[model samples]
Target: MAPSYLSIALIVLGEAFASQLPLFETSSLSQTHLTAKELISSKSLQDRIHVDNLLERANTLYSIAQLGEDEYNHPTRVIGSKGHLGTIDYIYSTIAQLGDYYTLSNQSFPAVVGNVFESRLVLGSEVPQSAIAMSLTPPTKKKQPVFGPLALVSNFGCDASDYLDLTSKIALISRGDCPFGTKSSLAGRAGAIAAVIYNNEKGALGGTLGTPSPDHIATFSISDSDAALYIKKLKDGEEVQASAYIDAIVESIETTNIIAQTKEGDPENCVMLGGHSDSVTEGPGINDDGSGSLTLLEVATQLVNYRVNNCVRFAWWAGEEEGLLGSDYYVSVLSPEENLKIRLFMDYDMLASPNFAYQVYNATNSLNPVGSEELRDLYTEFYTSKGLNFTYIPFDGRSDYDAFIKHGIPGGGIATGAEGVKTEKERQVFGGVAGDWYDPCYHQLCDDVGNVNLTAWELNTKLVAHSVATYARSFDGYPKRTGIEATAVLDVPLSKYHGPKLQV
Candidate 1:
């Protein structure tokens, strides 16, 4: 059990000390409480899910992201950023209110965090277009830029041969097929002094290299239109040389994963749910994940009022935006015995895209674990019972569930959508723009509180409540977790992906 006194101490210290924590709120402690002895059910739990509570949480997260403006120059909650630390404290303090009802532990880990001080990209005498330095990339020297003739590489720069004959030149690569780190490394291997990646879609590009790569050269990302303009010039027999300068810093920073498990249930058979707590370096990520994070928070808060037959673990993962660092670390540290105790895992991400679709992960794929289909059915059934239309998303490993799924855990979740375009058929099912991106502000400076669609978010939050309550009551139809040795690893090259649809 967690040290119950810690919760008491935090409460007794008054709002002064807790207020010192970023975006701390005392208002949550006054919510309506239910009788602890009442049996938990789907209705009882879902009844407690309220839109007002979620909206308030969204406002708090937006406020937390704003706190970063003084330190990060933008509203952000990227790993190791001030806004992210505040998010951690806020979650910790909120869960701390449960006292010993939940066993809480802050799992600390080292992560590589990067920030762009400044970056500039110019295509031979043309006005400089907007660009952002890819995370974990080394910066160009002060006042010294990397310049050479521009050569658009064949394919997506996933292979070294694509950069042949491009020695000392700046390689222009498309965004797809592999990770940004792989592309940058391939460019460097071909003797390219610098590399530029353009978005496959019609927006400004923001990307990451996944991890530090010694072979990586200074890299920058530009929009698709900018790249098309330069591509046309080069194709029209015009010589295009590029000069790029990026001033950035990459360093190892300490961060933590917040894990809270119920103390009143069966520890050996646990039901786990999680969402990424940290956002991208862009805007306040209320929809990107703040929506999902608060879903878990609100559920866990109300969950304490009832008893459960199975232990429930609520994890607010850190460093997820930096390539699932926190969740991966969590899985790596668990012993085989400890891992088997987790019967199933559910992930919640992007529950509130402004242009939304009801999406549940497709568990029918042969790649999923034994019980995955059952988890999917639970969600589809809930939506069906409500006469709500939902679609199936591929198991692309784009979120924190990647680690658990990789290790053969039956995992499932819901998402409104990310940068992927919504289909006309989806428009017929769920009202939204068919040809537009689900969340246009995905990983951009506009994913603030306003980005969330409260209607969609509220409906998904109730689904989350239903899933938690059902599993907490009993894992009756759910398959029991088998020994680790019998589990087969999922055969997806998930590391190559950086977004919802794009490979890089």
Candidate 2:
């Protein structure tokens, strides 16, 4: 006969407690000791949050990013970089202060990370236009720049026939027909030494090649106006000689994900909240994710003062900008039984876009688990209670929640915005510039501490505290997971949602 609910609960509890490693850092437990045993509530936790604390933390992250500026020539917390490693240390040390209240462990995994030292595009010896190196592009040999005559590819460089006899020439391609990876591959195959992909829309382009390929040459993304100038020159039979310098390298490195859980809660049922700790290659990422990660950190810090009947796992994921590498690796390792113990998962990413909108993930996707809608309702109710207007964003799987949702784990989260433009309707509701991107500095050099909107970030942080405290105290109203096989819930289409990676 199959095991009863009590037996399964007992088994999960025993295994969870047995497998949990002890808190590794023991030095400063006396300094930030936990004493309160009162039940966690929205008021109790939200009252502890302060905007000053968030600002101080964001400033600290900026300083850490600045420490690695000598290597990248920019302050960035990209994975495998000095800034990101420093960030990992910061999170670990911060959580370690509450040594007796939580069990902390670092999950180390091998990841292929890309680094771009320089991305330069100069037309006819004029000043270099603003350009960013596409991630995963192979570095030029011995730091040598590739100089060649610019040749425009017919169509969007999606096919081989679109190229002319381009041996030792650079291919100038438009960005509409296909993925950046396809264009780069075709350009290299056509004997082009380098390639430039211009955006189809406004603003500077910051992109990735999805994955590294031997056929991908030194590819860079430029704005549409720059592409237009070159196209006009080429159309007039002008010899637009181009010089491309892309210093980039892809290498395998070990990255760490910091996992911390309350030691006093029931281990069988857990409420997991996560945010990516690494940033893109362009900037300090203070707003893009520093806001979200620091929010979780701040909440976790304050949470130690209260008691929880259900487990609360706070995760600082690594390699998120590289397509949710850390979270994906995490879920892939969980056994079916282990997957069920995680009652629900909530992801927080980019909570403070400069021109922000209160977005709640509408878990209306048919593939989302039974309790996903309930999770959405929880966030909506919080916003409603505060008389705040919020818009519903689809469960597009753009962040760390993609991995959890794939395994039928009930999930939902909040995002201020990313590269998407703010609609006029959104402006009327949230009152920001409609024509501009929600976060113009997203994935660019301008995404530093100044990019964060303190007002929006603080509000969202309170919501995070509210949701975490609610679930931590009890999953009473939340749907209980039936002891169904994990495979049964794995029917969600993985291809439907794009995690962090932009197809363009």
Candidate achieving the largest TM-score? 1
lDDT of 2: 0.81
In candidate 1, how many clashes are counted? 0
Q: Name model 1 segments beyond 4 Å from true.
A: 1-36, 127-132, 152-168, 174-178, 189-191, 198-206, 222-239, 485-493, 498-504
List residue ranges in candidate 2 displaced over 4 A: 1-36, 122-131, 148-166, 172-178, 198-205, 223-243, 365-367, 423-425, 432-434, 444-446, 482-501
Stretch of 10 with least lDDT, candidate 2: 1-10
lDDT of 2 at 58: 90
lDDT of 1 by residue, 1-504 (tens): 123323332342234332333332333323233223666789999999999999988888877777678777888888876677778777887887655567777888989987777778888777446576787787764536888998888887888777787787988899888888889899887888888998887788877886788788888888998788888887787889888888888889878898989877789999999999999876789997899999999999898778888889999998888778888899888899899988888999999999999999886535677887898899999999999999988777788877787676788888999988998999888998999999999989999988999999999999999999999999887787776543423335655553332337
Identify the leading candidate in terms of lDDT.
Answer: 2
TM-scores for every candidate against the unseen true structure: 0.86, 0.82
